[model samples]
Target: MTEGRKLRPEERILWGKVAKSTRALRARQDEVAEYEAEITAMLAAEEAALARPAPPQDVVSPPGNQLRAPRPAPSHQPLEKPVHRKLAKGRLSIEARIDLHGLFQDEAHDLLLDFLFRAHERGMRHVLVITGKGSSMGSEGVLRRTVPLWFSKPEFRFLISSYEWAARHHGGEGALYVRLSRPRRSL
Candidate 1:
C-alpha cells in the first residue's frame, strides 16, 4: 500500500476491510486497557489495606492514672425489686402519660427515656406508656414488645421500679403502668 496512491476497485475494497478490522481491534485494545487499569487500582487498594498495622488490644489510660479492667456488659434482665408486691387495686395513679402510637422505634425509645428521666427528677411515682395493640399484619405490634425490653435495660432499670399492665379504664393490654423510683439525693 503506497501513501497518497489511488487504488484499483478490488484493492480499495480489500483496504477498506483492513481499515475496518484495525479500528475494531483498536477499540478492543482500549476496552482491555480500561479493564486492566481498574484491576490495578483494586490490587493497589487491597495491598494498602493489608500493609496497615492491626489496632492495639489493650486500652491505655492517660498519664497519672492507672488502667482499670474493662467493666462487664450490663445484663439484659431488669433489676430485681426490693419489694415484689403488686400495687394494691386503686392505690397507684398515673401522674404522667406518653403515647408511643405511630412513632418509629428510635423516636419512641428516645421519648420514653426522656419522659422517664424527667418524671423521675420530678419525683413522679406512676406513669402510663401507651403502645397501641400492633397491626393485624404478620409483623404485629413492634412497640408493644420493644417498650418492655427497653425498660429492662440497665439505664432504665435504676429509674423504673416496676411496670405492669394498666387497668382496663387506663389502657388495658395496650398500656403499662410504670412505677418510678424516688429521686436519688446527690452527695
Candidate 2:
C-alpha cells in the first residue's frame, strides 16, 4: 500500500488481471442475488393465491344442454299464428283502400292499418288504394313508390296476403289493390 513505488512490468500485468477477475465475480454475485429475489417474489405470490378462495366455474356442458333454475309458467297462453294466404292471385279474400293525398308518413301508416283491420274484420275480399298520382306534388311520385316499401316491412307484412297494381278501371298507377287474410271463425 505504498503511495509511490515503481512496479515490474510482469507484476503490473498480474495485478490488472486479478482486478478484472474480482469485478467479474462481483457482477456474477449481483446476478445471482437478482435471480433469487425474483424466485422469492414468485413464491410469495403463489402463497397468496393459495390463501384465497377460488371462484366457482361453470360446468362444462354439451351443445343444447345448460343447467338452469326452473321458471314459473307464463300467465297467459301464447298467441296462435294468424292464418294467412301464401299465394298472390285474382281477387284477395279481403281488400283495402288507402289515400295518401295530404297525409304525413305516420298518418298514412295509421290509415293503412285502420283500412286493413276494417277490411279483415268485415271479410271483404279485395280493396283498392288511391295514393293519388304523386306527380302533382312535385315529387314525381317518390312517395307513391315508397308506400309499397313501407307495406313490405315486417310489421305491416302480416296483414297483407298479396298486392298488385290496380286495374286500369280501378285507378291504375295512382292506386293499388291489396288483399288481406280473412279472420278465422273459431267454432
Q: What digit string (tens of lDDT, one per residue) describes model 1 on residues 70-175?
A: 7543333332343212332555456799999767899999999999999999999878899977643333577987788777566787888777777676677788
Alpha-carbon local distance difference test for all models: 0.72, 0.60
TM-score of 1: 0.52
Predicted model with the maximum lDDT: 1
Which one wins on TM-score? 1
> By summed lDDT, which 10 consecutive residues of candidate 2 come out lowest?
72-81
Name the lDDT of candidate 2: 0.60
TM-score of 2: 0.46
Please report how far candidate 1 places residue 138 from its true position, in Å.
4.4
Please, what are the lDDT tens digits per residue for candidate 2 over residues 45-157?
75566456455555666678876744422122111223122112333332445677656668787888788777778887566777766554234464466566656555566
